[model samples]
Target: MGLGIRALIMVFMTIFTLTSVANAAEGTATFYTPPYVPSSCYGYQNNGVMIAAASDAIWGNRAACGRSYRVRCTGATNQGVPQPCKGTSVVVKIVDYCPAGCQGTIDLSQEAFSAIANPDAGKIKIEYTQV
Candidate 1:
């Protein structure tokens, strides 16, 4: 194959990968402070920006530890402290697994959470893509 064709193939693959990731993430989002037991797949931390996802069929155990994703809150809140969505997005590292009975698809650290949302809003709808 020619160099130009090979480059085009690589670009197409990248776009396809990103599109798949974006479509896979469509659920609720919330934030939290750490210091929990067993730590996360990347070990423990009480501060800094990060996020967690469920260890279900969607994201396998410890598989997403070092990955980053761009998350965007897509709508206005109807719950505690209304934070109207501004379509802003933030990239966060995956550091842990979602807590049992957690209320969202992804749980972010306060720093990561505040990047795309107002601090007062406890939960919001979000769409994310791996980066």
Candidate 2:
């Protein structure tokens, strides 16, 4: 390959890698059973099944409300399931607080969790990005 062509390829590869890294964030996720209403951000209002609760790390004093995040399961958090990801992603709205002692970084609704990972896994490693 010509020197110029090789340099161009390297530049494009660098840009692509950086863009992917900038958009994704690693976190742990767990599913919560129904009765998703009466959220701390929205009281008794239904926000659909594609909803989640932000952990203290991203709660930002309730600033996370109404925000949407795209989440993909990366792996299982335990040996109960060696591979939990279904090779899909789910976009969920932040409608509540997961609290300081929340078991996961984001508490996803059962439907949302099932979209990305097996519900039986309970908790899984995830890659997410605000959208």
Candidate 3:
């Protein structure tokens, strides 16, 4: 190949790799108010406010405990908060499980949720990746 074409191919390859690493799972999030103890994973130990509960989809049958995820608010899931995202992300440790009938992919503690979105949003669209 010509030198120019080879450079172009390399540039495309770099862009592709970068995009792959940046990809995150899209999901919904809801905030759970405290009394954040007696958790299924820790059992009454305080894991602090920057914690979340994984839904059944990500729970991995209790293996999710102690895992950390970086969650970013993508947008509002309901009309109640049309612009609820706070334009930031929060990292939270998995401290519990959000069992069956859970409304979101991850249930963030109220403090964690408010760090990335308006509390009034209640539930919001999110992009998350294990960190």
For every model shown, what is its TM-score relative to the native structure? Answer: 0.67, 0.86, 0.84
Off by over 4 Å in 2: 1-14
Relative to the true structure, candidate 2 has a C-alpha RMSD (angstroms) of 2.6
Q: Least accurate stretch of 10 residues (summed lDDT) in model 3?
A: 17-26
C-alpha lDDT of all candidate models, in order: 0.70, 0.93, 0.93
Counting only residues 3 or more apart in sequence or on different chains, how many pairs clash (N, Cα, C under 3 Å) in candidate 1?
A: 0
**Candidate number that wins on TM-score, 2 or 3:** 2
- The per-residue C-alpha lDDT of model 1 at residue 55 equals 38
Question: Compared with the true structure, what per-residue lDDT tens digits does model 3 show for residues 26-117?
Answer: 99999899899989899999999999999997999999999999999999887655799999999999999998999999999999999999
Candidate 3 all-Cα RMSD: 3.5
In candidate 3, which residue pairs get closer than 3 Å at backbone N, Cα or C atoms, i.e. clash?
Answer: 38-44
Candidates by TM-score, descending order: 2, 3, 1
Model 1 Cα displacement at 68 (Å)? Answer: 1.3
Better of 1 and 3 by TM-score: 3
